[model samples]
Target chain A: MLFDFEIQGGDFATAGNASSQIKKILKQLNVDHRDIKRIVVALYEAEVNVVAHAFGGKISAEINTTEVRIRLVDEGPGIPDIELAMQQGYSTASPEVREMGFGAGMGLPNMKKNTDEMHITSVVDEGTTVELIFFLNQTPPNH
Target chain B: MIVKEIVEKLNLTVHSGEAGLSREITGGYTSDLLSDVMGNCDAGKIWITLQTHKNVMAIASLKDIAAVILIKDLKPETDMAAQSETEEIPVLGTSLPAFELTGQLYELLK
Candidate 1:
């Protein structure tokens, strides 16, 4: 199955729509409970990154019998230093955003921790793209 | 323990999502940052936070959190409450602050 979702920047009200929808679909497909949790966490962080930093972005997810791959591409001021941005305490979110309990610098690291394989690419002043993969075959939901 | 028992123990107000009052509560987490909760909170745990936005509900649903406890008597926004209803994740409120509420909750759960 393939799912595509568009994210609007600064739209906190609707930010998690895509993640929520994807969760339902994953459940319907009988994805393992553990895998669904990991995938949903990674996907929600990616969606929030777009809403917090980019003007807009698109998420493409491909789910097969064995694994799920997600790609998030955003248009905005891309990250100049991916390594620093991945740090546990690093964040560039606005004060207002922070007040709402976001932008604590754990987003990328969490995404990486939840996925089996993850890659990130960004260009300053241009855009950013992130790829996350989760292997669903290793441990079934009930395992 | 289930959410309704905690509600009785802590004197928390059921702001919305009464349908979820019976959900089991395995644990509790307190964080103002959404990412912290997302990365750290376990499923079926109750989330204790001060955020009163709609995104909080989104995170609760995504993480499969049993319920949300709003601090300092903070109330959920209109739409946030609506989402709680739709998602069937109760958004409970309390006049006690985060620290005190969490302490009592931890004691009960422990």
Candidate 2:
């Protein structure tokens, strides 16, 4: 199954809408509880990234029998330093965002920690695309 | 312990989602950062934070948390309460700081 959701920038109110829908679908599909938790964590962080930093974005989630692939494309003031952004405690969120308890600089790092495979690409003045892949129906890995 | 018992013992005020009081509390996590809780908090845990935004409820629901306790007498945003009702996750409040409340909850659950 494939699903798409729109993300509006600077809109903290609806930040988790996409994650919420995806979570419901995963539960209905009877995805393993551990995998579902990781998926939701990664996706929710990505969704919040778009809401907190981008102009707007779209999320495409595709679920197959063995895995789930999610792509988040955003129009925003793109990250100039992908490596730095991936580091924990690195963020450029506005003061207003920080005040809301969301800009603690853990989003991307958490995203990487939860996904099985991830890729990110961005243009300084244009946008960013983040891909997260998770292999499903597998025994939980020791963490 | 169940969420209902926690409320009674802690004197937490129920701000929304009374139906969820019956839920079980397996553990507790205290963090003001949304990503901190989202990334690390386990399911069925009770969250203690000062964040009152509507997205807090979103995380609480998605994470399958038993309940949320807003610290320092902070109240949920208008839409936050509504979302808690829809998600059936109770939002509780206390005048205690996050530190005090967290320690108390930890002692109770342990």
Candidate 3:
């Protein structure tokens, strides 16, 4: 199954809508509960990141018998230092975003922690794309 | 324990989602950080926090949380309560601070 969602930046009200939809689908598919939890956690973090930082973004989630692949591409101020941004306590979110109990610098790290594989690419003034993959045949690694 | 019992015992005010008052509570998590709660909270837990936004309801629903208790008499944002009703996950409230509410909840669940 393939699903696509459009995300708007600073739209906190709809930030996790995509994740919620994906979660419901996974439950319907009888995906392992633990893996479902991991997938939703990572996806929710990524979705919120787009809302908190980007101008907007699109998410494509593909689920098959063997794996789930999700790609989030956003047009916004791209990360200048991917390594620094991946750090647990680093964030560039504005004061208003922080007031919502987000931008605590945990978003990226939490995504990485929950996914089996995570890849990120960005341009200085352009945008970012994040790809996350989870293999269904294997037991989810303990986090 | 179920959420309705907690509300009765703790004198918590039910703000919305009263339909979920009978949901079972396996545990509880206290945090204001959205990501922290998302990453660490488990299903069937009651969440105690001060965040009033709709995203809090989003997290609660995604995590399958039994209920949300806003500490210090904080009210849920209008949309948050609406979503709570939609999701059937009770949004509850109290005048007690998080520490006190958690302490009392811990005693009840323990």
**All models, DockQ values?**
0.92, 0.90, 0.90
What is each predicted model's overall lDDT from 0 to 1?
Answer: 0.93, 0.93, 0.94
Candidate 2 lDDT by residue in tens digits, B1-110: 89999999999999999999999999999998888889888989999998888989999998999999999889999899999999999999999998899899988989
| iRMSD for every model | 0.6, 0.8, 0.6
Model 2: per-residue lDDT, tens digit, A41-135?
Answer: 99999999999889999999999889999999999999999999988998899999999888888999999988999999999889999999999
Per lDDT, the best of the predicted structures is 3
Question: How large an RMSD does model 1 have?
Answer: 1.5
* Residue-level lDDT tens digits of model 1 in A64-103: 9899999999999999999899898899999888888898
The native-contact fractions of the candidates, in order shown, are 0.97, 0.94, 0.89
Write one digit per residue (lDDT tens) for candidate 3, span B10-108. Answer: 999999999999999999999999989998999999999999999999999888999999999899999999999999999999999999999999999
TM-score of chain B of each: 0.99, 0.98, 0.99
Worst 10 residues of 1 chain A by lDDT: A134-143
DockQ, Cα level, model 2: 0.90
Q: RMSD per prediction, one decimal?
A: 1.5, 1.3, 1.5
For model 2, what is the alpha-carbon lDDT of residue A84? 91
Least lDDT summed over 10 consecutive residues: which range in candidate 2 chain A?
A134-143
> Which rank order by TM-score, best down to worst?
3, 2, 1
